[model samples]
Target: MSSTPTTFDVRADFPILSQTVHGTPLVYLDSGATSQKPQVVLDAEVDFLTRANSAVHRGAHTLAGEATELFEDARATVSGFLGARPEQLVWTSGATFALNLVAYAIGNATAGRGPSRFALAPGDEIVVTETEHHANLIPWQELAARTGAVLRSIPVRDDGTLDTDAAASLIGERTRVVAFTHVSNVLGIVNPVAELVALARTAGALTVLDACQSAPHLPFDFDALGVDLAAFSGHKMLGPYGVGGLLGRSDVLDDLPPFLTGGSMVTTVTLDEAHFLAAPQKFEAGTQPVSQAIGLAAAARYLEGLGMDAVHDRERTLERRMMAGLREIEGVRILGDASGVERVGIASFDVEGVHAHDVGQFLDDRGVAVRVGHHCAKPLHARFGLTASVRASTSVFTTDDEIDVFLDALAGVRPFFGVGA
Candidate 1:
């Protein structure tokens, strides 16, 4: 380890990884879906539930006040993660819910129900990239269909990259909203966010970023990144499964109507007229994820203590090694190389003569875990002429020894299937 204490010891934390998988030592590489919970994050959640369990934001009791303070402090912690104002963050169930909130709210605005600022109409176009996860794609497709607007996509190149020149041309005056992924879940391709944001700004479109992949392992600044809104999941960042966030500029968030509303969002209510509270509270209507939010806050602090840059550096090194090793396999083809662009530690590939499920099982039998499927990017798979692929993703705690075990397991995969030289 270097003099800097950024080193991650695999056996030190993560109780789950300490056990054997199928009677073999475990090798976990599926961080693209969700990361393993560290002891600190687990301890935080347990502490909150055991001691400070109560409803937040609408109570006067001691436990209530403590819960409220921790919940808001969690909001502040996540806000600091993205370099946004704490009040600018909205708590949702997860990344999917966060994406749906924006989609539904934008759909409401298009139907003349939300604030007038988001009034997308007929003949308007919404642009998305072919590489986007369904979380970022299908919602806009539904919005475009509902509004009678055109749904356009920036086509991915042969190497699974968006043709930015094509994106500049396709995002015309009629483009009302442009949504894209900051990093691809399947391909490990980090899109050109600043360039795309500039183009969207030029086209007078609202830009929504799906930062579900980038937020966990990279340094993020929603404002400096020039995104109107960005969404991420707590589970992917080493927290529990059911907490997520949507970070937006305060003014833009203020414009959107609440998607899930019941009790706590209202300021005043009448038979036919209702007024909602301000940005964060308005969007977070019901009893929020009190324990999960606090868990995610601790996860955020855990990552912060590790430092985002160090995390990025460690993951980048692992990704390069993983990519190089995977490519050396004769029948394996990686999805996107990105042509030297910076990316995180997610990588997807396909074996020429093996089904992705079989590949996944083969790897699993040897104690290596990976994700295998379209990865919720069906259109992206079609773009690459693939039905499914095997994805291996890593995080800060992933060690080179684990990768070596993974590579050794993967080397035998083709021979077992009779598909290799």
Candidate 2:
């Protein structure tokens, strides 16, 4: 495979894209919600289940060994994809669980069982941005409430960019943890992660990132970013559902307590207490998502083979085209700063004189799939005086024709609703 896979080749690998919706060809533009999977990812999961099906790390049998090897190899593959070590990744159900693990572990530590380095006390603060998904926002909010720590947020500027100057001011010595999204799931704008991380470091605060919107689209080196921890989901990255990971600095994972405990995570168990395994294993309990992990590894490999620089460049062109198309449609106001800021291929907007749901149904009728509603970032929508908006996101498999179809469908929405000029 070359550094850049052609769009036709990429689209061919995804079987579902060949289908039709309401008698029109399916023009999928909702990659931000969850990406459609490729044949290789699907094949990987089935191959694992059919041949090497067994409990990982528990049995001494041959099948168990094969399963364990495949599972661990997947870990190594995914870790390498993120510029991390296998020891630094912990498997979870998805990004939501990954974020919860960090928050819950901090809460548990503050209750006096885990490391003091993670414990939060009164007057200590946790900072996040206004544009965070509820997955990132609520967990930290609950953590602060549980630990008596105050929660602070860096407000978003009018253009949908984060107010980094305000973040620098709010993240003082009292701030214990600083969490933010690498890209806004709603606004489609990229945040200044390095700047925010530097601010948090200057205040001696730990940093966490929600990378669910980034890992599949960009080449990520977590260690290079200088964050203490980050989480992302596999399903959003052309991988299977029900599996994701928490990638952290080894020192931080060593200090944090296990969020879940049961079989396989233990080294020794007395009648009263148990000794847990090392960092990655200590955090993974019960039967693991073996097939999902293997599939996700394949997805990572598929992305790497295509090369992230090429993926980013293709998506940048698509985003510019989509943005320009949206601007031509009167009353279709984009939700964020419509300037020369950087963003992924996510375009979210509100059409005047039409409810988001109505616009969404109109699009669906025309076989154009777009994400509607708050997108789990209600606070971000509330900032724009909107209860909801429509989002059309792109991926490596997205085509120019699909984008044009979406724009055409959007242009017809108002006229169909009898609200045209």
Best by TM-score: 2
The C-alpha stretches of model 1 lying farther than 4 A from their native spots are 1-6
Query: TM-score of predicted model 1?
Result: 0.97
Q: Under the 3 Å rule for N, CA and C atoms, how many clashes does model 2 have?
A: 1
Residue pairs with backbone overlap in model 2: 159-337
RMSD of 2: 1.8
Candidate 1 residue lDDT tens string, 155-245: 9888877899999899989998899999999888889999999999998898999999999988988879989999999999998989999
Return the TM-score for candidate 2, rounded to 2 decimals.
0.98
- Which residue ranges in model 2 land beyond 4 Å of their true spot? 1-8
The global C-alpha lDDT for each of the candidates, from Candidate 1 onward, is: 0.88, 0.92
